[model samples]
Every structure is written in structure tokens, then in C-alpha cells.
Target: MKPARFFTPENLQIVKRLVSRYPPGQERASLVPLLDLAQRQHGTWIPPSAMQEIGNTTNLSFEQVFAIVLAYPTSFQWRPCAPQLRICDSWMCCQKAKQRDNGIFEAAQSIASQYGVEVKTTSCLGACYGAPAFWFNDKIHTDATKETIKEIISKEFT
Candidate 1:
């Protein structure tokens, strides 16, 4: 996390959007989104330069960057992030993770990827309280229903 990072003009817009989420005096709070942008745009994981960029853009110290980066369990190896969305299929969810009209999650998977979000059926997303849950881009959506999937697709991928 020592070197600075450079971004293409298009990707720079994303950085700006992430940075805009915080108040003027709380720029450092944008670190999470900045790191996510770095991983999503650069692929696999956030490199040293990306951490440096986050720290520089947020006007934080290298030590701050080091601590936060180490705190999160970001992966070094790439997975199915090309549109990764894992729907919970634990016993409770197996019954709920479905289209209202169907008994399986196949339709949900199809609908998600049709809108450009790759998906799978997994056991748990730590949202037992919300039986039907899904994980996308490292964030979890609890109480996921058909309408929820549609809305997320429209709001985020559209």
C-alpha cells in the first residue's frame, strides 16, 4: 500500500462517486467504497497502489489505510465476481428462496443474470432472521423476495 494508483478517465468517475458519499470532514469513511471500486475495476483484490489511492483521496495516513485494509477479509484470489450473487438456500430459505409462483430458485438465478448479475444458491448468508437472503458484491440482502431482486437489478445494474 505504498505506491500511488492511477485510474482511467472512466474509472475516475467511480472514485468520485464513492468519495462523494461522505461529508467533507469525514472523507476517510469512503475508504470501503474506494477499496471496493479498486477491486471491482482492477480485478481480484485491492493492490498496494489501490490502498495508497484510497488513503490519498481520503486524506488519511498510510497507517490508517494499513489498519483498515488488514481489518477486512478481502480475498487475494479471484472468484465469480463478474456478477457474483449468492442466494441463501439453507433449509428455511430453500422453501422461501423461490419465485412466488415456483418452488425452486432457478427462475431467480435466470432473472438476476439476465440483468447481468451472476448468481448461485448457497447455504447461508448469516441472515437467518431474514430467511431468504442473498450476497452480492460482498453485501448481503436480507429478506430477499422476487420484488427485492427486481428492484436491486433495476437500481444497481440497470
Candidate 2:
């Protein structure tokens, strides 16, 4: 990927705080958080230089940082268009009031048609406590019903 351009000063400040969360001798542990911040700032998969910057800042090798990005779904390396909607397909979500029956699929198709949005399925959002949750862009909608899901698009999609 090309070097991303959205690593603004404000974002750097946030990264600085996250980096400080780790002990002084364990800066390498902050790689995931730094990558997360970078993805959030750039709104897509990380640019190589951003990964490199993470490595350089944390005293980790470039390869080590690159591996972390590859492993996390939290990485946002693409523009949010026909955007990725990871509907929870895990068992907990299926048992919820807003179960992932055909309705979920139908609504996803309809929304994708209406707003040109794209839908995807992820195993779990780590929000099993809030099963039937939906991920739009980087935000989570918990206890979502079909109408609620529709409302999410109507309210957020332009």
C-alpha cells in the first residue's frame, strides 16, 4: 500500500498517550494500539511508512510491526465505501432477539442496494455481551434490530 497522508498532529498526540500506557521498558507492546490509531486516522489499511513509523517509534523491527497489522481486523486500510459491515455471525448473536436469520441477509442486501453499501460477516465482534451487534465503519451498534439496523443506515448513510 502507498504511504497514507492522514497522520496529522492531533492523531500523533493520541498515539503519544497510548504509547505512554505501556511501561517504559515495554514500548513494543504498544504496537497494536499504535497501529489501531494509525488505521483510525487514515481510515484504511496502513501505509507502509506508518508501519515503519510504528516500528521506529517503538524500537521494534519493521517486520514485527507489519505482522501485527496483518493479524488484526481492526486495521482499516480501505476507504469506507460500500463499506464493510461485519454482522456478527457467532452463536450468541444468533440467539439474540435480533437473530441473524434471513432478515439480516435481506436487509443487508437491501441496504447495499439502496446506499451501495457492502456487507460482510465476521465470526465475532468481541461484543458477544452485545450480541446481534453491527459494526459500521468503526462504530458498534448493540442490541440491533432490523429496524434499528435500517435506522443506522438511514441516519448515517448519505
Instruction: Give per-candidate clash totals.
Output: 0, 7
Clash pairs detected, candidate 1: none
**What does the lDDT come to for candidate 1?**
0.71
- lDDT of model 1 at position 58: 94
Predicted structure 2, TM vs. truth: 0.79
Best by TM-score: 2
In order, the Cα lDDT scores of the candidates are 0.71, 0.75
- Candidate 2 worst ten-residue window by lDDT: 73-82
After superposing candidate 1 on the true structure, give the runs of residues whose Cα lies further than 4 Å from its correct spot.
1-4, 75-130, 136-158
> How many clashes show up in model 2?
7
